[model samples]
Target: MSRYREFKMPDVGEGLTEAEILKWYVQPGDTVTDGQVVCEVETAKAAVELPIPYDGVVHELRFEEGTTVDVGTSIITVDVAPGSEPEEPAAPVAAAAPVDAPAEEKKPEGRQPVLVGYGVAESSTKRRPRKGTSVPEQPQAAPAGTYSAPPTAAAVQGELNGHAGTVTLDRPLAKPPVRKLAKDLGVDLTTVTPTGPDGIITREDVHAAVAPAPAAVLPEPAAEAPAPVAAGERETRIPVKGVRKAIAAAMVGSAFTAPHVTEFITLDVTRTMKLVEELKADKELAGLRVNPLLLVAKALLVAIKRNPEVNAAWDEANQEIVLKHYVNLGIAAATPRGLIVPNIKDAHDKTLPELAAALGELVSTAREGRTTPAAMQGGTVTITNVGVFGVDTGTPILNPGESAILAVGAIKLQPWVHKGKVKPRQVTTLALSFDHRLVDGELGSKVLADVAAILENPKRLITWA
Candidate 1:
């Protein structure tokens, strides 16, 4: 008797309710083993590959590629045992599955549920690590048409035990994540000499050739003139999808719905800067990135604690305000693709060193555009560090559901009071914008003042909080 089992998308990470199917490694009729890479899923935080949990022949695909299915949705159905009747030849194996099944197909409108693990549940609210972060080492090349075998015209099955075979390439093309990595490392993937099968450039090839020949410097013009604009200059338009889509929707939602009010306060932060330097030299904090942002993050956390109203959400449909005790601290980051804020869960519980490490990873991940959609969710409050751009301050928009967002300006040398006398000191401005519907003037002022007070005197944070 033929037995079958369905493989639903598992909750890949902590409380991850759903994920978008990026691509599939196997297709209908292909035999997949336990722990084999089966599909790539883009969670809210990063795009992660899910390995098959059982050995079986792929029977049917539940959802097509690019479809954002809820967690526990049956993505694929497998036949664990060979059936009495011979199975028909399956469709071509594509890197991506069709997002929406055709109307003619005899399938449920929603995806099927996988048999094992937590059944996919309905999730509400649509839409949507850096420094020393080691990129995973790429495996050796695999041949085409064979999951695990040497390159040949005839297709072979499982020739290399469990390995996906050497990929044959007409020309080298890199994935988006790989391309981003190359750009960050200052290496052009096209220029790097490829060693993979059929002249494919792998990560190893990129790491091997560390220093490439520098670009030729153009000679300085004897007399400079304004650069002439080309006639009918070409323009390129890239379609916005995935995180970009969710971001656009959220921005429109917040901008149109929320009544925003911004407040600014400037204070001398010499002590906070001094603390950062001291922490950098401390033995316990060694190997951690000690930056001014760390103190600012901690200050923000403290302010949220004192003024919980600022760490709240206005539930229009529910006709109430939801206050969150735990803080999911969002850090606004700019990447090659667009802006993303991946919050640190339970941020208020972390120590300074722990917070530093989290911020470092968050910034790096966002810049790499690897932040999954899940990390950008459930943020109670946020901090935007405009300091990196050398700007003093600006009114930052509230991150969709969050009640408030704090902006930290650039730290610079300025004249200030010392022992009741004027002197030079390090100072910075803080701008806070809140949803006036949820946060009153007194409450907003207190939150911003609390953060500014911490920066003015780091010792106050230790004593008060």
Candidate 2:
């Protein structure tokens, strides 16, 4: 007798509606424990590894890697019976006959996993296998706990041996983009050495191996494939189905749903900058970064004390505007994965040094995409420093739940009229945008003006206004 249970993707975050599958750890037919990591999922802020909720054999994979699925959707099915076999052949087999598949069950790329998301009714298009259809010999990836592969062919082979399954070994281990790069350079990946952890091949390794080639060998005659043609003559198009797709949807939702207004103010920022320099010279703050944004954040916090409405939000469902006294200050950061806004909890209560440390930790975690769901939620206000990119200032979109966002422009040398003479001073711009429905012109201007005042005169932050 076989007892079967479906493992639905749980809401990893508060009120999370859905998640996109990034990759799978186990295939259908594999035995899995109740708490073993089964797959990686990307939410609004970070990529999280999901643990299987039941101890069982993977009877069937309900969704494919790189698909977006709604929360509470079954991602994998398992059989509790001891002797249960995983659904079918584990190898990449030919497309199977439909077995009571869902009406919306699509076979994009002829893959079995379901794409997770809202309003995306159709499956994504199919993904073509690279030049070799055969799995790398000793398919199981590097042993558990081993570093990922180095960027090279031999390293890739080593990683394949560690995989759970057998690899055909004839194919290259690099991703589609890397493969294209190799083909364009006429560099056979099998001959290149991998430098990635656990013997995996990395893009940098490929690029490094490529540059020395031309210098090492004389250029081929004009009759040979021109360098232009040698570089992949055709373009590769990757389907936007997983994290990217989810990001697109979220950006759109945040962009159009909220009506936004922006206000900018320029400040000398001399005293605050001086404070940061002094802090950098202190022994206690050594090894920690000191930036102008810390002062700007402190200024914003002080201003929030004078004007609480700036940190509030509007709740349209109940026809009410809710005001949050506590501040969950979100810092918008750009990472390799994408732009993520993770906030510091109750930032208003932390001391100046503590706030600096918190900001440092928050940015580092968000950039690595390791910020937990708990740390990312419950935000009341946000700040984005476009100044770091060396820009003066620009309007910033409000984070979905919060009512206002402040953009800090670059602090640079600018001539300004002070007391009586024009002199070179460190100046920057601050742009504030708020929810017009909840914040009227008066409140919005007052809040923005207050923040600007604190920056213009850092001493104002010394006392309550």
Candidate 3:
């Protein structure tokens, strides 16, 4: 006899409640080994791959791809004894049982599944009741090819709406992506009939609801009939989930919780720009990212060293100021998904060449959307290079729990007084925003001034350090 093991969704991010199944690498009957990655999931922080801890044959996928599964729910099942004769496939109709079946009922006696990083919690095997319903009775599997899937929540509710005398309070049943599409299309899913298995509303249903009906008949065309205009979609709605959702929540918390104070300064960076060119030519720094941001980041590190007080965070629970001896410097990079700030750990201790290498790796990783949550956490300060977007500058919000964020504007050639004469100089604006409660005006000013001085004269990096 073959024993089956269930693999539950683990909490990949810090206290995240749920994650969307992005893709599955293995399927039913596929042989898997210990520590083999079975699927990839996207949490609010980043995309992560889940590895099966022990070897077995994949038995079943509990949920479809793009389904947002709550943490701790079983996602896949594996049969440990693969050499045994393959059992008959379970009927798809039976698989339609309300996913809220009791955890004890689903698991075989005394079998525990463990995931990496997230150890098994006692409640890990239990399934919480779905919103607005008690535990439902298990439906019997229909004879082969004789039964249809259960009605979707929408269809059941629709029948209630049309014929039932009593009102149903249960919310409509749809996947997160389907709900987002319904929201984007300004359609009430409850009013639309469902055609999907299990009566679930799908993306096509939402789009169908949005489409306008055509005229029954057309009038005779005139000699000069205007060309039919191409219909364009009025708006695009992106679901606020995954990394984008995390960024939204963190930014809102930082903005409202912290008393932000912003300071701005314009300075000449002719020397810094020239140093970028020099570094590019240096064989030691070959194949490394050599840019003005490199010098700016180095300058910021030096400033933090000089004005250490500006590098501290406000501890709300204890009402104390916690000063950091190490800096996890966050570099804000705009990716295809959204803006992600992945940082270099202990950046204050890295040399210029090391910093360049870290920055290059960070950019490449973030661009590929492979940045891990560990790379994004524990930052002391952040740098947002709005300069890449060709904008002069704007005040940037502080990353939550951090004291300060520095914004670097576009470095443009502007006429300035140099050597007692007017000349075109490499000019840029710097905006520094800090948690006012933690960083006072004098401390913030000194840090910004130090960074500006280094950029204005690149040699200050060596002397100041």
Q: lDDT of all predictions, in order shown?
A: 0.68, 0.65, 0.74
Q: C-alpha displacement of 426 in model 3, angstroms?
A: 0.9
* lDDT measured at residue 334 in model 1 versus the true structure, 0 to 100: 76
Clashing pairs in 3: 152-199
Cα lDDT tens digits, model 3, 1-465, are 124667778776757899989889998999988557788788877776677755678889999988999987889888765666544432222112344446543432222223222222211012245567665443333222121233334433433443323323233445533443455457887898877754456667777888732111111112234455568856555567766788899899999999999999999999999989999999999999999999999999999999998889999999999999999999998765578787899999999999999999989777766676667878889999999999999989999989999999999999999999999999999999999998989999999999999999989888989
Q: What is the lDDT of candidate 1?
A: 0.68
Best first by lDDT, ranked: 3, 1, 2
Q: What TM-score goes with each of the models? A: 0.58, 0.64, 0.67
Best-matching candidate per TM-score: 3
| Clashes per model (N, Cα, C within 3 A) | 22, 51, 1
Higher-lDDT candidate of 1 and 3: 3
Candidate no. 2 TM-score: 0.64
Question: Candidate 1, which segments miss by more than 4 Å at Cα?
Answer: 1-30, 43-45, 52-84, 87-233, 335-337, 360-374, 415-424
Q: In model 3, what is the error at residue 287, expressed in angstroms? A: 3.1
